[model samples]
Target: MTNHIVERASARLNESTLLEMFWGMLLSRRLDERAWALHRQGKIHFHISGMGHEAAQVGTAFALNRGVDYIHPYYRDLALSLAVGITPTDFMMSLFGRKDEYSSGGRQMPSHFSSKDKHIISGSSPVATQVPQAAGLAFAIQYRQKCGLVDPNDTSQPRLALACLGEGSTSQGEWHEGMNWAGVHKLPFICLVQNNIYAISVPLESQMAVANVADRATAYGVAGVVVDGNDVLAVYDVMVQAVQRAYSGGGATLVEAKTYRPVPHSSDDDDRSYRSREEVAEWKKKDPIMRFQNSLLEDGILNDSLLHDYESRARAEVDKAQADAEAAPLPDAEEVFGSVYAPLEEQP
Candidate 1:
């Protein structure tokens, strides 16, 4: 089904880049499985699986200029974080809540990814807060350009901010407010909503009256698009266009990627309580990772041996990360308030 899609993508991206995307998706899946195992063993407090959304996350991550554009990702963006350069070791340290964890120094929970070097802003526990923050970042980029702080003539440098959220967050006022502001200001922002059919136990039909989340973008006067989230190449193409528009001074874009959450909302939630087993089974047949791999094999870009090698490497990396993280030290109790506020000496 996706052979033609892969062929089209090959026209725009090389085989190496496609393989990198596959590796990222595979690594994300392995890491998510590891996190779930750690939680079940009582080694971690909570776990949010990003199993089905890896295609969308990784596809969009590769579309952006990784160290340049700011990313305000929701908690489910495990694949996105990894594609943007966050290592498996970083994720393991975060899961183990080690003192040296890059995201928050062990303050934030697992899956709440952040990295200063990668330009991934720290996210809050509250949903949709990153929407406004992303808008602000985009505005700042434009402001700097106007103030001559950034070289306006540098066409190679694209200043944009990407904010990702679940479909449920589209109901939040922050989502609307931030998107509206970005539209009104013509900010370099790309708002991506991963529609996974359900928000916790609540289904999409109950959340909004619109057919698609991107429909809301119409009210904000921004370009709205919907894509097949399971098709990594399709997602990459859409994101490339959106990023180009933003870089060329076009207004914000609202992209709704139709995906599925193969697992429950979190380890604590029971998916069986609300959804049917058959429904999940149906979606499993469309697993993005499997689909992408099949497409690569059909196009002769990948083979069984290469796939096996990549999967083995990914599993080994995850195992090493987990072992290293387990041995790492925890944050000291005395420094509980360390990152919360600045010390008086550094206030000035």
Candidate 2:
């Protein structure tokens, strides 16, 4: 049997792709910044920064089908959600817990993003739960010979489910269960482990034996590879192959992206209790936004002026989105009972 060779290359991104990636990263970053501000201002209950994971999210999104494919994204994957047709307004509304919020019926706290219209499943608060759900959704598609939540004969092609998680979630039973099932069934799914080296407060050394979570794929008889998660183009290339492999019946692939989390786990947690200032400083050297911007500049795709312009635009847009969200009316108290399973009388 021949082995597959999908190299994780760190080459220049196409000029257009570089611009698009930069713009996307800027939007994701600005959104996080404003969301955090909202939390501080008492406008939002909680906030999570997708800061360091922007490369992994946006790059992965560029590699998959947006409206056609399904994405079982975790809370930290705001960039992925945005890239897959989730408007800034939608995300802001979700963050503000307003009536316009599509994911939660205005009930879920901020960061739990979803879009039924785009087939991006609403992520749960339970850790690692989405891993198995993604594989299960993929298996159902193959079993029914069609896509779920849509007509079977749409000819949109059988979409793959890309589920991402924090490296810490890999310690859970659901991770192994999802990987094993995908391997056994040759399901069209991709499990991406974002190894940011901290599970809220627990360090990576305490979580897994291997340096890379990708190494664990050996147990499931699947291909595993690690890429520079801070390198957007590199992540993009790997995701491209992973998505193509799954769509072409090559089965599941596990990509362990080595990244860092710039902010504390959430608004409530203080990272200083567990991590050293020196450690955070070290990780800052690998900042995804800076690295990706350098990649673009070195490739002659962008200059400092262009980068600044894009970021300014993104920041302004984020401000507008936040303002719109704050101005939108909150969901009425009784409306909470609306979307949950409908009325008992309506059930057959």
Candidate 3:
């Protein structure tokens, strides 16, 4: 299907909401940038840069209702997590493997964010694990609404669950299982495929024959859209439509955001071995942060001075959060048993 294009100007949206979304993107960018720098300094063990993904992440966050809606985010979704109110300190704590880290209490490796209160489900290192979990949550929402468990008369909407992952994850068995089940049941779920061109060292073209990730939606009989992930306004408009569809019982929609990773897959992998430096440099020119900022400037919604101030504040906040996280205590060996499960009684 042909994509319905939206203007790249933020002025087209509600002014206050547009500003909020812009600020959210800026904050997310700053957090990710600081984390990457910390990794280089050896203060944090590893990091993933969301440099070319701020638009999609911020747009999706603005479209959804935080705490009300469920979000099953992938490892490369630090910007989305932070944009949805996962604090810089919380992220730093996780990066530093401190006891106060909300996701896994420092047990999980860095970049896997999870929070019950924020409705951001815990991330797994395994690919596509959150896909089925998101579908299940959407099913439960429908069940609750049908059973009159929630306000039936309101008709405002039932909550939705978003399962977001990289395009490479689409090749995983769990991805098919989750999409198939949700599509069969006509559940209110949204699957966001961030096609950053490469899945580790492999490109999307090598993984699938389809022209675009959205084309896979044809098998499921749902609306599909492919958008420029670097365009924040375009992404926001598309996500708003998807959110409306799911909430209105229009069923699941699969969105493929065409973007770039702009960095190695992770701290361990070296893309320079398999990918060309020229390709990386070319993608840097269309960097999501620069693109989104340009859009805001074009719309006359933000000046360079304001943008600089926001950047400065973001940097300061990240530094302070890192300091706090670094100073926090690590978990004791005995404390590990407290979180596993309830104690069992001894047999007679």
Candidate 4:
């Protein structure tokens, strides 16, 4: 939470890792902008963005076992999905509600990310619902290890469950119950609170009395931590600690990443009424992508040529994904309830 603390936790990141992080951040930004463009053109019905939260999400994602750990990501987690190996094509398919998309097969709303190979659990609209689901999954992992179905001695990949949400969801009963349950059982769980200071339209102060969401972790008996969400390196450093602790059977942790959302909550909401243009502009100057780019330049890891190449690649990737999704077919009305019920032979 403090500058001194951050320096102490900071790890020496190599050039390769730094470049990988930059590429991930770039991919996320390109896809996010394309989504907004589609929405403005009336090509999509609704869109929620993760513009200001890229550093926090991408940094946390790099610390996990990419496809092995179970991740339950909330809405506004487009960056998180992309960072964790969910292809731009998969994201576009879901945004367009295409029939072949793996996440709900175009039945559910967009931003509910899911991938069978990646082990990403599809999220719902109800706030904090994934909190309990993540905890339950952690319990299942614990049971599997205990039953010898999963190797507890496997140090290469210590499985865990991650629950991601906005700071506002911390007030929900499900959030409290889930965190408490995990703490009681010492489940290998991590609760990531991307604190962007608002619950739809309500400010952080109005929604909760505490100064920081991480402050409540004490009551749950889990380790509480806060970090600069805009600083990718800082967030990654802290996540390294949390992941190691979980792998070493250190139980659960609550990470409150302080961030800000510069865009409107969604296409349906007008941000002008609730926030000031000056405030948004001020936050824009602290854009995580630019800040990281500056750092890379200073470290000699990025140059004008490399920057241009990365940008061009990212744009092309997004362009191809958009074309693919737009050309794909939508779900059929005849199969509205296709996967809802089991067939007679499979039904007990």
Alpha carbon lDDT of each predicted model: 0.89, 0.83, 0.83, 0.87
Residue 172 lDDT in candidate 4: 97
Q: Write the per-residue lDDT of candidate 3 for residues 204-276, one digit (tens) a residue.
A: 7899999788998878777789988987777888888888888888888899999998878887778998789
Note the residue pairs that clash in candidate 4.
Answer: none
Better of 2 and 4 by TM-score: 4
| lDDT score, candidate 1, position 111 | 85
Q: Better model by lDDT, 1 or 3?
A: 1
The 10-residue segment of model 4 with minimum total lDDT is 1-10
In model 3, which runs have C-alpha deviations exceeding 4 angstroms? 1-12, 152-158, 342-348
Identify the leading candidate in terms of lDDT.
1
TM-score, per-candidate, Cα-based = 0.95, 0.92, 0.93, 0.95
Better of 3 and 4 by TM-score: 4
Report the C-alpha lDDT of model 4 over 1-348, residue by residue, as the tens digit.
Answer: 222343534457778888989899889988988889999999998788888899999899988888788899998788888888888998889889998786888988888888867878988899999999999999898888878887876745447999999999998999999999889988889999999997878999898988989998889989889988998888888788888777778888899999999889988888888888998899999899999999899979999999999999999999999999989998888768687776889967
Per-residue accuracy of model 1 over 177-241 as CA lDDT, tens digit each: 99989989999999999999999999999999989998777788888889899889888887887
- Flag clash pairs in model 1: none
TM-score of 2: 0.92
Over 1-348, each residue of candidate 2 has an lDDT whose tens digit, in order, gives: 112445643354467866887788879888888888888999888888788999998888888878677788887988888888887888899888899588887888777878778888888888899998999988976776643464444447546888889999999999999999999998889998888999999999999888789888888877787988988887888888887778777888899888999899999989999999998999899889888788778977889899788978897888788888889999898885686576789878
- Cα deviation in Å at residue 128, candidate 2? 1.2
Model 2, global lDDT = 0.83
